[model samples]
Target chain A: ELKVEQNPLFLSMQEGKNYTIYCNYSTTSARLYWYRQDPGKSLESLFVLLSNGAVKQEGRLMASLDTKARLSTLHITAAVHDLSATYFCAVDQGRSGSRLTFGEGTQLTVNP
Target chain B: GAGVSQTPSNKVTEKGKYVELRCDPISGHTALYWYRQSLGQGPEFLIYFQGTGAADDSGLPNDRFFAVRPEGSVSTLKIQRTERGDSAVYLCASSLNAANTGELFFGEGSRLTVL
Candidate 1:
């Protein structure tokens, strides 16, 4: 079974600070995804890292993938209050009908 | 709908009662997925469908849980003899193709509360 693990499941950081959420998978996979979910809302796609050393950045959030190490990271360059939400990293099994195995998720609370 | 749609945004059911959840994928999407999200946890894959056929249903907890997408556009998830453990948010997602190497449009999810 493919297992995805994320660190600092609960993070409380002040606004303007920087932090990084780590995602590590147990199996070899070709794709990684980042999603953010707010209270009572569905997931919003953040990034899709398809290859080794692939990195994507949008606004204050950036994501990178390292396929060889089976790891991906979501880095927050400068935190903001609106960035408070639960972030999940999912690994695609890379099958015909792709199934995603998700990490435990990191709940970030940005204090203003 | 412009995005994936799930019906019964919130459901409260008694133990052992039968419940059904519905999902409507985005128009032209060929791949659909079902996932269960418990409190404080990430979404867990329950099943995947390619058009009218279920490509993978291995993530389903047991035989009591069943889903069907006969027409391929809409899907219904049926659960019999539900238990408290079944209380969770059921999420529906759809992708453009079978490979799922792209972004998946997700529904707001139906929160099932088995009390």
Candidate 2:
């Protein structure tokens, strides 16, 4: 079974602070995805990291993948109040099955 | 619709009743996935459909949960004799293909409550 663990499940950070959410997977995988969800809403895709050392950034958020270590990170740079939400990292275990094993998720609360 | 759509945005039912949830994937998407999310937890994969056939259903908890994508576009998930533990948000997602590289687009989800 593939297991995914995330650190500091609950995070409360003030606006303009920087933080990183870590996602560690138990098995090897070809791709990792970062998603954000607000209360009562579905997930919104943040980044798709496909290869080792792949990094993608948008606005105040950035995501990177290290396949060898079986880890991915979502970094928030200078967070804003509107950025408060739960962030999830999912791993595609290099199988054709298209099943995604997701981390427990990091609930971020950005205080203004 | 511009993105994936799920029916019955919210459902409230008593235990032992049967319920059906619907999903309409984005146009041209060849893969559809069903997931369940409990409060404070991430979504758990329930099933995956490639075209009109289910490519994988291993994540399904039991026979009580079954899904079908008969037309290769629209899909329905049926629950037989629901339980309080079955109450959760049912999310439907679609991807361009069944490949690992494809990114998933999710629906708002159907929040099911079993009393």
Candidate 3:
């Protein structure tokens, strides 16, 4: 079974501070995804990391993947109040049309 | 027409009742997925359909949960003998293809409350 673990289940950070959320998986996989969910809303895709050393950034959010380490990270640079939400990292277990195994999720609260 | 859509945004049912949730995937999408999200938790995979067949149903909790996509576009999830523990937000997502490179588009989800 593929297991995904995330650190800091709840985070409270002040605006303009930086933090990073870690996602570690127990099995070898080819793709990892980062998603953000606001209260009562569906998930919004943040980044799709497909290869080793792949990194993608948008605004104050950046995501990177290290396949060899079986880990992915979502880094927040200079957080803002609007960035407060729950974030999840999911792994695709290499099955054809496979379902995703998700981490418990990190709930971020950015104080202004 | 822009993204995946789910019907009956919220559903409330009594225990032991049967309920069905519907999902309409993006046009031309061949892969659909269903997941359950408990409060304060990430979405847990339930089933995956490739075309008209269920490619994987391992995440389904038990035989009481069933899903079908007969026409390969729209899908329905059926829960029999609903229990209080079954209350959660059920999410539906779809992708253009079944490859790992494809990104999933999700619907707002249907909140199921088993009272």
Tens digit per residue, CA lDDT, model 3, B22-56: 99999999999999999988899999999999998
Q: Which candidate is the best by DockQ?
A: 2
What is the CA-based DockQ of model 2? 0.80
Where is model 1 chain B poorest over a 10-residue stretch in terms of lDDT? B97-106
DockQ class, candidate 1: medium
Tell me the DockQ of each model, to 2 decimals: 0.78, 0.80, 0.78
Interface RMSD of 1: 1.0
TM-score per candidate, in order?
0.98, 0.98, 0.97
**Model 2, range A67-110, lDDT digits (tens) per residue?**
99988999999999999999999988767856888899999999
Per model, state how many residue pairs clash.
0, 0, 0
The runs of at least 3 residues in candidate 3 whose Cα sits more than 4 Å from the true structure, single-residue gaps closed, are none
Worst lDDT 10-window in candidate 3 chain B: B96-105
lDDT string for model 1 (A1-112, tens) is: 7889999899999999999999999887668999999999999989988889999999999999999999899999889999999999998867787688889999999999
Clashes of 2: 0
